[model samples]
Target chain A: MESGNLRCGRRLITSETGRGEVVKIEGRISFLGEVNPKEGKLYDGRSIKGKVLIAEGAKGSTVGAYVIYALKYYGNQPLAIIFEEETDPIVVSGCVMAGITHGDMFGKLDLRDGDVVDVWEEDGKLCLGISKTPP
Target chain B: MHLTREEERMLKGEYGEAMRIAMEIVVKVGEVLGADKLVDISHAHASGVSYGTIGEPGLHWLRELSSKGAKARVYSTVNPIGMDLDDPNKIPVGEQFYKKQMEVLQAFKDMGFEISVTCTPYYLRKPKPFERLSWGESSAVAFANSVLGSFTNREGGPLAVASAITGKTYHAGLQVLENRRTTHLIVHPELDDPVEWSALGYLVGEKVGSGIPRYPKPPQDEESMKLMLAASAASGGIALSVLEKVTPRGTYDIGDEERVEIDEKEIEELFRFNDPELIFHGCPHSNLNELKKINEIIKDKVSREFWIATSPKVFDEALREGIIQSLENKGIKVVKGTCSVVTPIERLGYKRIMTTSAKTYFYLNRKGLEVALVRVRDLWRVVT
Candidate 1:
C-alpha cells in the first residue's frame, strides 16, 4: 500500500468534506448519459455511493449538473469528486449546488480503486491525504 | 479577481439574494478559470430546461431560484423543455410528466427568460460579429462562435443561468481573443450534401476533442454549417470551428499545425436508409429555408409518421409562410418547444428513429434508441 499527500488545484465546493475509498474512472465522464442518476450508477454498473470518485473530467450535456444533483438526491452521491484534469463548469456547478466536495488534482496519481483518501480544506485551500487500502 | 463596484454590490446582496448567489457563482467560476475580471455579455442562453434530462431535483432547484426572485438581468433565453409547450398533447407523455414539464418551463419563464425553447437562438436573433455571449447549448455555442464570429465559452446550464442573472461571465476561454486561434487543421472533403457535412463534423469532433479545427474551404451555407457544427459539438466538445472565407476575418487565426484529412468514403459510410417508425427533422430547429425545402419536397403527400420539431417562433414564421399548414395537411406533426434528443422517445413508444442530423443520430443512440442516418434530399424517400 502506498500513502502520501496530494495537492489540489482549487476547491470548488467547500460546503462538504469527505474521506472514503476511491472509485477511479480512467477517462472523462459524461454525467448525463454515462450516469444513472436514480441509482447513482455509472454505465458499467458501478455504484459511486460514498466513494471518492476520481475521473479525468466531465463532458457531454450541459444538463449533466442535474445528473450530479440527482446522485445527491437519490442518496448515492460520492464522498468527493477529484478530477485529474481541471474541472469543467458542469461538474463545478453540480458540486456547488449539491454541496459535494470537488477539486482538481495535479497529474495522475499512482492510486487505484479502494484507496482510502481524505479530501478536506486547509486555510481556504483544498487538500488531499491518501492511505492505500484494498477492497 | 477584480469586480466592479456594481458587481461588488450585487455580491454583497445589495441587489437581491438571488443576485448575490448568482454573482457568487460567476465569481467562483471566474476564479477557478483564472479570469482577471467579469465581462458584460449581450445575451445568455440557459440549457437543462428539459424535465426528462434534469429530472426532479433539477425542477426543485429551478423553482427555488425562481422563488428567490432570480430574474434575467440580460436578454436571456432558454433551451427546449421535455415536451411541446404550445401543444402538450403532441408528445406522448403521461399527465404527471406533462405537468412537471410545464412547471419547469414556468420556472424559467418566471425568471424572465424569453422561452426561446431552441438550440438555434441564432435564427431568432443573429449575433453580430464579436458579440459576447454566455450560452449553454453546446451546438449553439459552437455555431455562434464558429459561424457567427461571436465569443462565448460553452457554458454549463447553471453557469449560463448565473451569467443571465448577473449579466456577466468570467472573461476566459473563447471570450479571450488570443485563445481563439488553433493549430489543428482538418482537410475537409468536398461535399454539397448536408448529411455528409454532418458526418464530417462528427468525425472531426471525435478527432479534435475540445480543440478548434480550422478548414481551408468549408461549407459556406448556413444549413450545412449548422448541421456540421451541431454534430461536432455533440460528438466532440468543440465550441469554435474556423472556416476560411465563411467566418468573419480577425475573429480567429490559423497556425501551421497537425493536418487530418477526411475522405469521401468515410463520410459516405455513415449514411444508411432504414425503416424507422419516426422520421424527425429540425434537431437544431429548422430554419425558414429548411422548412421551405421540406414543404417543397412533401408537397401535400406524406406517407409516414413524420414529425418536424422546431421553436414556436420559427413555427409561427413557417405558419405565416403557409409551409406549416402544407406540411400539417400531409400528416406531418410540426411539434414546438421540444425535440427528440431532450424528450424521452423510448417511453413515447418510438424505437427506430431516422434523421439526417448527426447530432440527433448521436444523442438518440446514446439514449439506446435505434437511429438511422440519411441525407436531407433523401428524406423524401422516408417520408413517402
Candidate 2:
C-alpha cells in the first residue's frame, strides 16, 4: 500500500490531466440526489470544485449524468474523478458529457482526503502520483 | 475489445463531430463494462428529458448536441418532460420552465426522435423478442428486458442518446445470453391486487439489488405486471427479471439460485391509508383498461382532487370513446404526456399523494410528497 505511484485499470479519458488535493468520499454517490451542483458541494458540505474527487463509484439515479453536467454549467465541477470500483454507466455518461477527467479500478489505492496528487496518463494508462506532503 | 471496420471509422471521426463524440462515449462505456464488441441496435429510447430533473445544464447539453447536427440513426423515442404538453399550465411551473421544456423537446426532435414523451414506449411500438436495443427510463428498460425478452442494459439518459446517434451499443450485461440467467428466486403470497403486486416488486427489488430474480408465479394481467416491473426498476437497478410464465421462454434460465420469500407483513406495511390532497394513478401511464376501470369505479363526482395521467395517444383514444368526458364530468382531470412523478407536482402544493403504483410511491416520496400506497380496489373509497 505504498503511496508513491499507483496505476488504474484503464484510462477512461486522457486528453487532460488534473493536479489537486484529494476529496475522498467513503461510499458510492448518486450524483443527482447527493450533490448540490450550484455550490459544487456534497450533501455533507464537502466542496469538490477543482478538487480530485474520489469515491467507490456511482449508484442510484441515472439522471446523475445531467447533474454532473450541471456542475460544469454552474462552474462548480471537480478537476478529475477516480473510482475505487468499476465505473457505472451513470459516471461514464456524466464524465463523457461533462468532459471531466476520470478513471476507474483503483480498489486498493492508499489515498486519503486532503492528500495532494497528480493524475495523468502514461503509455495510454492512468497514473496517479501521490505527493510527499502530509495532510 | 474488437470493433468492426465501420465502428473503427466512427471512432476515428469519419463521421461528424456529434457522431464521433457519441461513438466515443458508447465505446468507453463498453470497455469499462466488459463489452467485447459493438452490436447494432434496432431502437433507442432516451430519458433525462424532464426539465425539472435535468435543469438548465441538461437543456444546454441537448442544444449543443442538436446544434452539432446529431440525429437519431435508428427509431428513437424520449421520456416524459416536466409539464403536460396538452395543457401546459396544469403542472404549475413558471413561464421560464415552459420555455426551457419546449427547447428540450425541440432538441430531441432535431435529433430525429419521436418526442413521444412517455416512459412506456412499448405502447407506441412493442419490441419483438430478442430485439437489440439501447433504452433509458429504468421502468421501460425493465419491461423491455424482463417482459419482452429483448436485449438491453439499463442505460443512462445521455448514453442512450449516444446510442441513438450511433445506432450501436456495446455487447455486455443483459444483452449476452448467459448474463440473463437468474441468480435468485422470489417467492410471494397469492395476491390479486395491483397495489400488492407493486409492494412485492418493491420488496424484491430492495432485497435483491441488481441481481436477476425469477418469479415462479407472477400476476397474469398486464397492468399488474407493469406495476411490478416499474416498481422494481424504481426501487432498485433491476434491468431484467425472469418471470416464469410471462417472460418469453428460453430467454432466461435458472441456475443454482438463492431463494428469497416475501413476508406478508412487509407488503402490509407498504400500504398506507393516510388521506392525501391529490390522488394520482398511472406512473407508467395508464392503458385503456385502466382508464375504463377508473371510469366504472368513480360513478359519483370525486369528493377530492383526482387526476389520471396517460400517454397522448391513449388520451386521444379515450377522448374518442367519451371516457375523457365521463371522467371529466366526475371532476377527474385526465393529464396527457406527463405524470405526477416526472412533472413538478410537489411545487403544485400538494402535501401528500395517494397512488397505486409502487413506482409512483417511491418517486413521489423522493419528491418530498408524503406518498401512500393504496390498493386499486380501494381507490374509489379513497377518492370519495
Candidate 3:
C-alpha cells in the first residue's frame, strides 16, 4: 500500500473511516455549477458516488456548500474528500454538515484515479493508504 | 481557541440545541482556520437563499434549524431568493417551485431573520468603519471589507447563519489587522465610465486571486466602487481590495507589494459583444442613482427585455421618487428578491444576455447561459 500523511483536517461530524475507489479532478471544482447532486455526476459525466474525491480546491459560488449537502441528501456523497491545498468555506462547511471525511494532504498524496484507498484518522492525523493495483 | 464563558455555555448546550449547534459550527470553522478567539459582530447577512441555487437540501437544513427554535441573536438580514416574491409571473418557474421557495423563505422568517432579500445589504444598512461584520454574499463581503473598511471574512451561508445565531465569528483572516495588508498594487488607467471600472476590476481579480490588491486610483463614487468590488469578488474570490484614497488610512499597509499596471486597451476589450436578447443591470443591485440614469436614457419603449434587479428598499426609494414608474412606462421590468446570477435563467429560455456588470457576465457564463459584456451607455443602442 502507498501511504501519505495528511497536512490538516478536523473531525467534525462522524468519526467513521471511509474506504472506496478514487476519482481525481485536476483543478478547482464548483460544486454548484460543475456537479449534479441528483445524479452524482460531475460536469464531465463521472460518477462520484462511493469514491474518494480529490481535487486542488473548491471554487465558484457559495451555493456550492448546499450542493455538497444535496449530494449527501441524495445518498450520492463521496466516501471522503482529499484536497491538495486548503479547502474553501463551502467545501469545509459541506463536509462538516454531511459527515464526509475530508483532509488537506498538502499535495503529498500521489494516488491516481481507480485506485482503491482507505481513509481514516489515526493519532490525531488523517492517514491515507492506497492499494498498489488499480481497480 | 479561547472562548468566553457565554460562548462556552452556548457550545455546551446551556443555551439550547440551536445555539449549541451554531456555536459548534463557528468553533469548528475557527479551529480549521486557526483562529485563536471569537470576535463579536455588529451585523450578520446570510446568503444562499435562492431556491434555484441551494435546492432541496438547503431548504431541509433551514427548516430543521427553524424547527429547532433557532432565532437570530444579532441583527440579521438575508440575501435574494430564487423567484421574485413580489410577482410570481416575472420568472418562468411554476407554482410548485414557488411553494417550495416560500417554504424556504418562511424558514428564515421563522428564525427571526429580516426579509431584506438583497445581496447588497450594505446599501440597506451602512456598516461603520472598523465594525466587525459576518456577511456571506461574496460581493457584499468584498464591498464591506474593501469599501466600508468593515472587518469580515467572506463567510459561506452556513457560517453566516451560525454567526447570526451567535452574533460572533472567528477572529481570523480579514478580521485580523495583519492579514488585511496589501500584497499587490494595480495601477489603473483613467476610467470615468462605470463599465470600464468593472472590466478593470475583473482583469485585476483574474490576475491576482485571493490577494489583497491596492489600486492607486480607485473609483471615486459609490456606484463605481460597488461595480468594481462585485466584479473582483466574482472573478477572483477576492474578499478585499485596498483603495488608495477611499479605504480608511492605517487599516492596511502596503509593504513592498508587487505592482502591476492596467491600461485602456484591456478595458476596451471587455466591452466586446454582439446582439443580445436581453439587457440586465444591477448584478449587485443598482442604487438610486443608476436607476435615475436609466430613467433619463430610455425615453420610449424598446423591443427587447430590459431588466433591472434591485433591493426592495431601493425599489421603494425609486418608486417614491417616481423613477420606477418612468422605467415601467418604457417597458422596463424591475425585479426584486432575485437577480440573474442566483436565479435559474436557463429555464427562462433566454439565450443571450447583455450586462454592464462583469460579475453578472462571469456568473451567467458559468450557468451555461450566453452572456455578453456591454457598456451601460451603449446598451440602449443595442436594445433599440
What are the per-residue Cα lDDT tens digits for candidate 3 across B1-384?
999998999999998888887887788788778899999998999988888767789999888878888999888999998878799999768888898889888999999999999999988789988999999999999998888888999988989998999999999999999988888899878888788888888988898888999998888998888899899898897999999888887667776698878888888876767578788999899889999998887778878898899999999999999999888888899998789887788888888888989999888887777887777777678767
Cα TM-score per model: 0.91, 0.96, 0.92
Question: Which scores better on lDDT, 1 or 3?
Answer: 1
Which of the two candidates, 2 or 3, achieves a greater lDDT against the reference?
2
Ranking by DockQ: 2, 1, 3
- lDDT of each residue in A76-111, candidate 2, tens digit only: 889888888888877887888888888888776677
Question: Highest DockQ: which candidate?
Answer: 2
Q: Sort the predicted structures by lDDT, highest score first.
A: 2, 1, 3
At residue B14, what lDDT does model 1 achieve?
99
Recovered native contacts, candidate 1 = 0.65
lDDT of 1 by residue, B1-384 (tens): 998999999999998888887887788778778899999999999988888777799898888888999999899999987888777788877788889988988999999999899988887788989999999999999999988899999898888999999999998889999889886799866798887888999999889888889877888788889999999999988999998888889998775668888888878777876688999888888888988988887765778889888898988998998888888888999999788888888887888888879999888887788887788888888888
State the C-alpha lDDT per candidate.
0.85, 0.87, 0.84
Clashing pairs in 3: none
Chain A TM-scores, one per candidate? 0.89, 0.91, 0.85
How does model 3 score by TM-score? 0.92
Off by over 4 Å in 1: A1-9, A18-30, A33-36, A39-51, A54-60, A106-119, A130-135
Q: Count the backbone clashes (under 3 Å) in each candidate.
A: 0, 0, 0
